[model samples]
Target: MSAEKKPAPKVEPLRKTRPCPECGKPSQREHYPFCSNRCRELDLSRWLSGSYAIPVAGDEAMADGEDEN
Candidate 1:
């Protein structure tokens, strides 16, 4: 039998930390870095209010593609 030894398994790094994107305070899991549900909701409201958007092709462009014209 050989005397070679296997190396230990590698461990994963801890989560990245940052101040709450909303309140600029330390983040926690329960409130998820926002401090509270109220803050979380406030952040969500901004997203829903067209403050954040993903671009999509206009209806006319899509129609032309379908017909290959």
Candidate 2:
């Protein structure tokens, strides 16, 4: 019996990556859109520290008034 050697399987990227939020490096599969753990942690830190936030379109005073009604 002859032994056949198979070619290595190709690994396609799971997602199209943009630059890392903390660094300019391309993303890795493990860390994803960030290049490394440090970048990921930095992003988390920013979020936890309130450096990142979502903007709401309504006034808080109006929302509070509506809630009472």
TM-score for each model: 0.50, 0.63
**Worst lDDT window (10 residues) for model 1?**
10-19
Tens-digit lDDT string for candidate 1 (39-69) = 8999999999988887766787676667555
lDDT by residue (tens digit), candidate 2, 1-69? 999999989987589877987889998878988999999999999999998888877888786676645
Instruction: Please give the distance, in angstroms, between residue 28's alpha carbon in candidate 1 and its true position after superposition.
Output: 2.0
RMSD of each: 6.3, 5.4
Superposition error at 39 for model 2 (Å):
0.2
Over 4 Å off, model 2: 1-13, 56-58, 67-69
Model 1 global lDDT (CA atoms, 0 to 1): 0.76
Give residue 56's error in model 2 in angstroms: 5.0
